[model samples]
Target: MADFDLEALSLSELKKMQKDVAKAISTYQDRQKAEARAKLESLARDLGYSLAELVGTATKITRAPAAAKYRHPENAAVTWSGRGRKPQWFVDALAAGNTASDLAIG
Candidate 1:
């Protein structure tokens, strides 16, 4: 590494140098990460598995189907899984003084 007289440098020049050093470090870190990832991928391929599979990130995420938790009173076809936001029908029923238990599916 080259020695520099940092104390002799003007404040503006020091700031510019700092910025340049920061940029260089960032670029070097990015290159290192890319190289590491490439090496991992190569090793994974040699092991007969993809990078994601080797990391256990390639597994398909599956969820059990949502069961009908609440059914519309007037329309049996209309249903809510009661997992997320309440449906407008459920809200309307609540506004009209119908309890959530009133719409519970068997």
Candidate 2:
């Protein structure tokens, strides 16, 4: 976050800030997910599982629990799902005209 420049923005200036921030967050998350896939692939190769097998397993998505059964250390607002698209709630909030930061972990 130190790399982020978020100083001196009026409420009216927040629109552009919001757009930049959303893109930045999505890019960062995508990087994390790709890294996770690569690590898993390397481990699979070491254990005799083919990259194809590892990738197939990774591509499958699992639904989150009904309540708060997950946690994210970085930002409580950001839940942990092994890295993917924004969760449904976040998408809904965005669609309803709320910024990502408007949501919280707890």
Candidate 3:
């Protein structure tokens, strides 16, 4: 049973509610850590790599083709065309050899 009315909670009651939410978040984080640790242990056994070896291997992996983040040169920075579809020059660049990926900032 609740100690206080739900509708009539004062500032102190709100503080207590916040503390309860924080405790719940802490418990959830602890549970997530436990689950991640268990998954890593199983994955390590299957891969025949220690946790440290797995991390070291992961760090060596390069970006994939689909995930490639390309950027144009700074000299290529445009004089901003006010809104709407890309300007004719931009379309021409695409039609020429430049890829949308090559122009992507991220």
- Which candidate number would show the highest lDDT if scored against the true structure? 1
RMSD of 3: 9.9
Per-residue accuracy of model 1 over 5-106 as CA lDDT, tens digit each: 999999999999999999999999999999999999999999999998867675688999899999998999999999989999999999999899999998
Cα error, residue 105 of model 2, in Å, equals: 62
Predicted candidate 3 versus true structure: per-residue lDDT over 17-92, tens digit per residue: 9899899999999999999988997899898977777676445666433432333334455532324566666566
State which candidate, 1 or 3, has the greater lDDT.
Answer: 1
Error of 1 at 89 (Å): 0.9
Candidate 1 versus truth, CA RMSD in Å, comes to 4.5
Query: How well does model 3 score by local distance difference test?
Result: 0.68
lDDT of 2: 0.67
Residue 67 lDDT in candidate 1: 95
After the best TM-score superposition of candidate 1, give how far the Cα of residue 47 lies from its true spot, in angstroms.
6.0
Name model 1 segments beyond 4 Å from true. Answer: 1-32, 44-53, 58-60
Q: Give the TM-score of candidate 3.
A: 0.43
lDDT, candidate 2, 50-95, per-residue tens: 8887556446677765454334433576463425566776666668
TM-score of every candidate: 0.55, 0.41, 0.43
